[model samples]
Target: MPKEWFKRVYVCTKPFMFMVFLQTSYAVKNLVVKSALNKGLNHYIFAVYRNAIAALFFGPLAFFLERKVRPKMTISIFLKIMLLGLLEYVFGILYCYFKNGSEKKTLNTERIT
Candidate 1:
């Protein structure tokens, strides 16, 4: 019974083993990224690199895996994506500026009193 149980546990398909490995690697990568952020790595640069690397890895997989069903990148779609990205960037900058500005004001008041 123990031997049968062992075989059952160990007899995973290749795709199952690959998924387990992928998830473990992703968890470890997140831990390392969090450690780097805590250590004061430049977050903007980190975000850029993270997004670029993700695109680099996933782009090919998407191209190959979904080539048959992937929707075409029309000019309208491209323009919409660009516009959305620009809006997000502008909003992020505004939010950060306001957030930091408030924090600075509080910090300065605390220092004064």
Candidate 2:
């Protein structure tokens, strides 16, 4: 297979692949939210917890799969991964906190009447 052909194929397929990914992700998110509501769980917690579970499950698989193709890891690589994980956790917490805080404010305003 020629390199140019590969590039053309990739360029043509990229949008379709992205669209499929977006649609699938949207559907999964809706299902998770609905299921959590039915189970009496808060939607924010459900979504965040679901994402954490997914990361836990896939994180190791990603490392294992990438190891076959990537260079051997060094201390710097480990540090970078740690930093990325820390950022992920911080952002996740901030998002959930803001969401829950706003929700509480709305509920409190309704109660004030």
Candidate 3:
């Protein structure tokens, strides 16, 4: 019985490790893309496109993996998550908008006419 348990654990290890590796890779790639955009992109389009692509890649995986455990679709949980998501989106947009707006204003003021 002990041997059988060990065997099952060993068999499950590879898939778990693979999932960790994939998640780490995705995080690193996202950080690199974000840094590149921050350095000189100066356009909301690039950020939006990157976010959309990431959502496209992860959304299906999340749905598939959580299909069995997904909480019974309920209004309260949905509202909670929606509110959190909206707060996050608003914070990010505000931060980026203010940062870029100030930079542009400074540059315009410094220009020789």
Candidate 4:
């Protein structure tokens, strides 16, 4: 019974565990970036290195895993994807303009401590 209960708990907690892992990773990234900047690393250079590292890690996974099951891009699907991306920024801009434009303030990024 305990073994079955453990398996159920693992399945239920998988997503929450992943969420915590991602949040922890971002926190570490921020700390490392701040430290590198303090030690004279250019932000742009750091960004390039970060992207390169990510590509190195995920590029193989994408190529191998998605090569078989990837969907073909269609014009309508492309436009829908682009629109979905723009909607977030458009709404954000409108909200910032309407909400705090007078004060020149916006919540572009939330710094969580």
Candidate 5:
């Protein structure tokens, strides 16, 4: 029947649509950051504020949504999350270092000329 055909098409396109939406979000985020940076936003402060806002938004949802079923925090779990956060920040630092270093070079050259 046409209903079955429509259901099959919807199921097949669901993941493809989700991926397109996700990619569009990432592209938009990058575009916004690039525009802000060009307008003199400090990357370090931007990174901190971005992370802080994300935590503030998601932390409560996580705490409330999973509170009933979540396991108690153990030291090992705490340490593992800490280590993972540290690793993520380390990559952020490396990315900022290389990116800002290149930008600085261009800035210095512009000043000299």
Candidate 6:
């Protein structure tokens, strides 16, 4: 009975543990980013480093997971990826406008022209 109980505990996936881990990671990331920005980290450099880190982690995973099924990498696909990355930066401008504009509108400080 003890052996069976141990096996059950070992095999059970502790989803709660994963949730705690994910939330803690998010908190730490937020704290680090806020502190760095408060210390005057350049936004451009921060964004580059963030994306580079993401790519370093995901690029290999993508290569391995999709290697057997994905289409061959070609110049067109490479160019398209570059374009998509560029388009992603447009969100930075959109974020600024929405955040700033909403604050001003809420305060009745400026009307959109």
Best by TM-score: 4
Q: 21-110, model 1: which lDDT tens digit per residue?
A: 999999999998999999999999899999999999999999899999967999999999999999998887668657877534533533
lDDT per residue (tens digit) for residues 8-79 in model 6: 876775776688899999999999999999999998999999999999999999989988998888999999
lDDT score for residue 81 of model 3: 92
Q: Native-vs-model 5 lDDT?
A: 0.88
Compared with the true structure, what per-residue lDDT tens digits does model 5 show for residues 1-113? 99999999999999999999999999999999999999999999999989999999999999899999987899999999999999998887668657876535533533233
For every model shown, the clashing-pair count is 0, 0, 0, 0, 0, 0
Model 4 CA deviation exceeding 4 Å by range = 71-113
Better of 2 and 3 by lDDT: 2
- Per-residue lDDT of candidate 3, residues 1-113 (tens digit): 99999999989898998999999999998898778877987558787877899899999999999999877968999999999999998887668657876534534543245
Off by over 4 Å in 5: 74-113
Off by more than 4 A, model 2: 1-14, 43-48, 76-113
**Superior by TM-score: candidate 4 or candidate 5:** 4
Pairs clashing in candidate 5?
none
Q: How accurate locally, in lDDT, is each candidate?
A: 0.85, 0.84, 0.82, 0.89, 0.88, 0.85
- Error of model 2, residue 23, in angstroms: 1.5
Ranking by TM-score: 4, 5, 6, 1, 2, 3
Candidate 5 lowest-lDDT run of ten: 103-112
What overall lDDT, based on C-alpha atoms, would model 4 receive against the true structure? Answer: 0.89
- Measured against the true structure, the TM-scores of the candidates, in listed sequence, are 0.45, 0.42, 0.40, 0.62, 0.60, 0.54
Model 6 clash number:
0
lDDT of each residue in 1-113, candidate 4, tens digit only:
99999999999999999999999999998999899999999989998999999999999989998997988899998999999999999887878767874424565654445
Ten consecutive residues with minimal summed lDDT in candidate 2?
A: 103-112
Model 4 misses residue 109 by how many Å? Answer: 31
lDDT, residue 2, candidate 2: 100
Q: Give every collision pair in model 1.
A: none
Candidate 2 lDDT over 50-94, as tens digits, reads: 899999999999989887898688999999999999999888766
lDDT of 1: 0.85
